[model samples]
Target: MHEFTPPSGTLLGVGLGPGDPALITLKAADAVARTRVLAVPVKARGAESFARRIVAGRITPAHTVLELVFPMRSDPEVLRPHWQRAAQAILTHLDRGEDVAFLCEGDPFTFGTFIYVFREVARLRPHAPVEVIPGVSAYHAAACRTLTPLAAGDDRLCVLPATYGVEVVETMLERFDTVVLLKVKPVMDALLDMLARTGLTGHAVFVNKVGTDEEAVVTDVASLRGRKLDYLSLMLVRNPARVKEPVLRGCRPKVGA
Candidate 1:
């Protein structure tokens, strides 16, 4: 006599968009609705989860919400254990044939906490079913809301965390036409100073909590100096005066001959 084993359920990384419930895609909503276990990331135990709040309306009594604590720190060693624990917790439900959907504020693979968990899950279960549902990133929403064109004909764009320091940011600004600085809370003043030094202060825009009711956009980025900013804030900078290589089209040079 032989005993049969049930197959594991799938792990769904659902991006809910940038703080806007309406921005969630139809497929993401369907996944959330069908999944019985909803794994949400929070800063601490019992803390509010921004990702969960984005899909509050979709949650029902039948759903089992699992809060995974992911502290706000950049130390990978400190975060690794948390990620492994979260992955194991989600896997437990999956082993029971219950699909687990991990909610994310933006695109799961774009600097989202889901990436860490996803990596751990893949390591733990090499053949586990997984699906990633993309959503509008914070920078994309900020650019669209500000009506700023990220890139155009031969223009380059760079997106990085502001914690990389002002020197690196300045170098990126020099190399790319458009630069998006994410999580500008710690280096707000330094970035503003660098922008002013590069004569791009007026071309920079600061967007905070984009797409939500408390969203704010600041055209005068200089005013943000010395002021505490939210972690969700980001800056979109455009350098129109950046030197571009001459493109020869039909025997005619676009720039100086």
Candidate 2:
């Protein structure tokens, strides 16, 4: 008699899009439909998962929902071990030939928790079959909702987390034609000052939870003073006064000439 071999299941990183269920791609929807084990990331135990909420309608009774806690902290030392543990838990299901799909908000690869878990899974299980489905990032949705152009011909764009400090944002504003600042909660006050100082305050727009019921758009940044902003909020700034200095490739002319 021939021995029976159980095939390992595939690991899929599905992006749920910004915050709207309608934004979910058909491919992601199909993945959620066929998923036997769905892995969802939560900020803490017992807390609702935003990623899960984005695809709540797709989850069926046959799907085993697994909640993975990834705390809302910036410290890598604190986060790495937690994700490693989550990867082990998901791997157990995959080993049993159960297809696992990890739900992520926004694009899975863009500043999302799925990347950390995905890396850990790949490191531990090199031969594991894995696939990633990209979705609309928050900045994209925010720009669309606010009718702001991220960039045009010969324009430069810079996107970075606002946690890097006010000085970093100042530098980005000076260099790039457009700057998209994510997670602006930590340095909201400082950023407001920087924007005003740079004479770019009117060009900035703030959007929170785009396409959801909690969505709020603020064109007047001054109103943000002493206000508590949501963690999901972002700021998109455009600098029309910014000038790109031409880089001379040939020999420079004499100063006297």
Q: What is the lDDT for 35 in model 2?
A: 88
Write the residue-wise lDDT of candidate 1 on 1-257 in tens digits: 87776788899999989988888999989989999899999999999999999999999999999999999999999999999999999999988888899999988988888998999999988778999999889999999999999999889999999998999999999889999999799999999889989999999999999989889999988899999899999999999888887665676666875
- Cα RMSD (Å) between model 2 and the true structure? 5.4
User: Would you estimate the TM-scores of all the predictions?
Assistant: 0.93, 0.92
For candidate 1, the C-alpha RMSD (Å) to the true structure equals 4.3
Residue 158 in model 1: lDDT: 97
Worst-scoring 10-residue span by lDDT in model 2 = 246-255
* Tens-digit per-residue lDDT, 1-257, candidate 2: 99865777899999889989899999999999988899999988989999988988888899999999999999999999999989999989989988899999999999988898999999988888999999999999999999999998768899999899999989998899999999999899999999889899999999988968899999998799889889989999999988888756468677787
CA lDDT of every candidate:
0.92, 0.91
Worst 10 residues of 1 by lDDT: 245-254
TM-score, candidate number 2: 0.92
| Model 2 ranges off by over 4 Å | 1-6, 247-257
